[model samples]
Target chain A: MKKKAIIYGVSLGPGDPDLITLKGLKILQEADKIYYPGSLFKSGLKSSYSLSILEHYKLDTTKFEGFYLEMDLTRVKVNELYDLTFEKIIEDYNKDLKIAIVSEGDVNTFSSFSYLLEKIKKENFNVKLIPGITSFALAAAENLAPLCLQNEKLIILPRVQTETELEEALTHFNTVVLMKIKTVMNVINNVLSKGNYSIYYSEKLGTTHQFITSNLEEINKRDIPYFSLITIKK
Target chain B: MKKKAIIYGVSLGPGDPDLITLKGLKILQEADKIYYPGSLFKSGLKSSYSLSILEHYKLDTTKFEGFYLEMDLTRVKVNELYDLTFEKIIEDYNKDLKIAIVSEGDVNTFSSFSYLLEKIKKENFNVKLIPGITSFALAAAENLAPLCLQNEKLIILPRVQTETELEEALTHFNTVVLMKIKTVMNVINNVLSKGNYSIYYSEKLGTTHQFITSNLEEINKRDIPYFSLITIKK
Candidate 1:
């Protein structure tokens, strides 16, 4: 009988190649194949932050195969994407190969791994996750700031969330991290100004083009990228 | 001109030795001295999970010195601890030695690093932080679950927070992570039962004695350690 393949959902950490956990690297190195998110592939593997990490460590990627998984959440039906990915994963598993689905930041947080994991649990293949540093945590480190104090709360909301949701979160939590802040720059600026909160913004954390600012005015004036994150403390 | 020393606040990730980022490990290996939280020293470094990680990775600790910094937030005056630690750090910096203040999980999350940073900001020494995988995130990974949906909010609150604060948080956020769960387990259990939330609990994550369970009843029947964490989905 052939051994069933396994899936390791790996979190690559916040954009820095060096930040990938040793266990994450070990799992990637030993895996039969590594699958990267479609977003990273579009940027090219040579320049991709995660792939750069493997190169920096002088790991032998030649022996392991790499694959790209496309994710168009807005346009594609979510279930279809899950089904296709699950099929692809099981096919590789049937061949007795260990597969890794690599995502930026921790695998369980707003990650593509979730979609696949949700669909694949009924299958016979073994699945596990390796966590990594989160982007908001990295942003806090970059600013030399704490996400929260004792008895305080932190709220993390995606950019696609309603402006009302953002405002409510800011009012309730000690620190609020708004992820993917490209389109809501003005809305966030307004909230920060009205709430009298300390604002820190960062885009593509740990990358060469990474941008960060504590100046609320500068953030309002600048063109925030789709990958930008804003942390507010009231 | 005499060079100034610096301190690196290293996030050691959850309990797993292999989970420490490569950058974190590199800094730890190269630091002239390493400072561990007083709580861990009381527990003994030989048995401490973080030290075990270094040993597991075969990093030579003999060449580098280790210092213990006392921190009893509940019993002692917090400022006095901060003042003493700041003085010790500056003395090391004056000798032009790189020092690392190691903390479990992310340094910016309810970490002692915050107090030190607040006290030592005006000093001549440089300070930087290295982010790590959080126990709550690791617990999510261990359960093969996601912390939140695309736009769902996540709340992280320490145990000292009042029961009212937790209830307020549960009403506001889609998911809530309660840290230091030993004292508040009953309150949390009551909340879970009332709110109809899905609960996942883990203690000493990544350690040999680590225990995790999705069954709320199992958790209620047992003695929850001070290091325990619970992630709830409402």
Candidate 2:
């Protein structure tokens, strides 16, 4: 039997290096090549969340294939880049190379890797996704509570497009988790002020830069980070 | 300074022993005493999911404190038992012992550890929750899809009280995760049949006894296990 060649979508958890599962660690260590998302920074610096995790664990950086992505790129251009990257993955796979694409937090929930995942499925490639601890779940853990209790409903929204959406969710669900709320901070805070709800805000969870506060006032004192999330428990 | 006693709500992930985070494994190994839930089995065979993970990893069972709880116990009796368990944990803490309460899956989401958590807080005890991979997330991974894509909403319900709950959630959210559906299986099936959504049902995910399928016909061929869950995606 020829060596088993496969692609693994690895979830490295929120931010803590120690938060990675044993299975995830094993795959990263065993893989021949790894695909990591590198974000373009000022002064031409390219850094990726998933890549930082691999470096934190002192993994072999030589095997990493960083795909530096820019936020300003058009939807058509981004797909073209992903398609080119997929071709590279397929070329290596056919040569019997094990590939791993690293993703931050849980891969299935609001992940940029979804673009590549769709391509992998369309081409009928062998893929396995290793689940990780979600940032919102970690926020709840840091707040010393779970999202919901018995018979309670929990809804997770990416960002509130309208105040009514947030208000409607708050009315129906006992616990509401809002992710990537940087743009909708004012709108969300306004609706939340009316309800006697407890808010736990976390930014860059599990990493050295992790911030956690239950007071919304303390949160508004500064500009929220792109990664910031609010978990509202009633 | 005092030796610094603390209670850790350790989440052991879904079922796979390799699924536990490095931090969670470290705490369990370094704990002075570990509290595990033991369930009564046939022919006096007491077993626990959390304990099984520890034993499978060959951890020291001598330091284990088994708290055998029956499901049919009254709510009052359950609270009374948790109170008694809390007292024992407190006594050990006062003596400067690090206590860990092992919970299968994430400790916060639909966990029995919540009962102990309330007591730990009311009496003012130092506690930390180590987050873990949720079974539903793992189920989604096994299904090769994330729960939701960009801007899509996700709702999680624990055993629907009525058919309307499931129907309403499906109408509003892009993805619906129903947990502990054994009690409300018929109602859920009835509502799901009318929709054009795909269903992925998983039982005992990440374990050697794991079962997964997207086909509703294959799932209905046998009795669903208590640990079973279905992830509905549009």
Whose TM-score is greatest here? 2
How well does model 1 score by local distance difference test? 0.76
Candidate 1 chain B — worst ten consecutive residues by lDDT sum? Answer: B63-72
DockQ of each: 0.78, 0.83
User: For chain B alone, what TM-score does every candidate structure achieve against the true structure?
Assistant: 0.85, 0.94
Best by lDDT: 2
CAPRI quality band, candidate 2: high
Candidate 1, residues B149-209: lDDT per residue as tens digits?
Answer: 6777788887734667778888877888888778777677666777677888888888888
Mind sharing the TM-score for model 1? 0.89
RMSD of model 1, in Å? 3.3
TM-score for the second chain in candidate 1? 0.85
